[model samples]
Structure formats: structure tokens, C-alpha cells
Target: MTQPGIDAADAASPRRIRIRTCVATRERHSDEKLLRVVVDPEDFTGRRLLADPKRRLPGRGAWITPQLSALETAEKRRAFPRALRLSTAVDTGHVRTYLAELADGPDIVRKTEH
Candidate 1:
């Protein structure tokens, strides 16, 4: 019982699919909206630091705090990639720059001289 043109094997072949999930949110002293990244859904592999609101990306996902301190810790101990179990090949400098921008904002500044 098979189709004339298509075969059962062909039908079983995997197709392009998208997975989505939240990793964790970045916080400052338990109350702050920093930044978040989208991770791979399939087994939670691969992590991309997302800047925009729209979490439109290919593959599964997890979220990450968008703070310099958190990012530094993640990068230092490499806990981020471990959580997702994939090689995180993102430039650390870009993350620093983003944190700096956030710091410039009134919300993050909080009259702190740093």
C-alpha cells in the first residue's frame, strides 16, 4: 500500500522544524529587566543572545540574563554552554557593548557612578 510517486520512506524523512523555549531571565538585585537570549529547543542546544523583542530564530531555545555580571560569570565558568550542552561561539565583546548601552539607560543607571 504505497503512493504512485511518493514512498513511505520519503514521508518519514524529517522536515525543517522550529523549537522554542525560555532558559532564564536576567535580573539585577532580583528586580531589573536586562536582556535575554533564545536557546535551541531540541535538547536545548545552541544559544544566541537576542536583542530584539521578537524571538524569531531557527532551532530550539532557552533564555539568558543580559547583564554584564551574569554574562561574565557565564563566560568565565562557561555554565551557559553547559546548560544547553552545545558550543557557544558568540563574541563576548558584543555582549559587553550591549551591557554598556543598558547601563546608559536611566532605568539601569539608578544614579550609580560606575
Candidate 2:
């Protein structure tokens, strides 16, 4: 059975979860638990990668686990170009800086879960 205006397929489908895959880990996770980045086209030298903490950039984006190791792994594997559908390498310095800012997120590394 379906609603008057809805297609049967639409009515039977489950609510979608916003999941994304981490380029470094090759794992799927909630977007909220991952970080997103995109290649900046206006850099004029080489493509520059930018972290989208707010997830607001306008072009194709890639997701990764929020760790410096993960970021470095992705960079080392040349995942950004494939993930973002670009033809060349991107400058990762900007994204690295962003990760540094959020490094260790909370001050308490032992028990403060907030």
C-alpha cells in the first residue's frame, strides 16, 4: 500500500542515512563522524585541498577519518585526485593546517568525554 501521492517504491524505502567512506580507512561511517574536503580550483599554482569543517564547499568532496594519520595516509596514497575526480595532485598544506587546529580536539585525553 502507498499514500495517495507517493509511488510504492518511495513509500517502501527506508529513511536514508548520510553515510560517507573514509578515503584512508576504506570504511563507511556517518558524515558527522568524518571530515570532508574539496579541491580548490582558484589556487592558480597547483590544486589546493581545503578542509570543510562546516561541509559547505561547492564542488565534489571527499571524506576521511578526522586524524592526522588518516590525512597523511590519504595524501600518501594520492586519494584526493581520485576521490574528488581531479586530474592532478593537490597541495595538502592547507588541509594539514586545518587538522592541526583540531588536533586532539578536547584538552582532556583521559576521561573527559565531552
TM-scores vs. true structure, each candidate: 0.43, 0.73
lDDT of 1: 0.50
Model 2, position 43: C-alpha lDDT score:
69
* CA error at residue 99 for candidate 1, angstroms: 2.1
Over the stretch 1-114, how does candidate 2's per-residue lDDT look in tens digits?
Answer: 777989888888867779999999999999999999987756675489888889988788999998899998998899999998888878888889888889847566567667
1-114: candidate 1 lDDT, tens digit per residue: 566887788767846443322233232332123344445334243344444335565543334465567667767766556554667564445456767787677554357678
Error of 2 at 107 (Å): 8.6
Ten residues in sequence with the least summed lDDT for candidate 1: 22-31
RMSD of 2: 6.4
The Cα error of candidate 1 at residue 14, in Å, is 33
What residue runs in model 1 are displaced by over 4 Å at the alpha carbon?
A: 1-34, 38-53, 106-114
Choose the strongest candidate by TM-score. 2
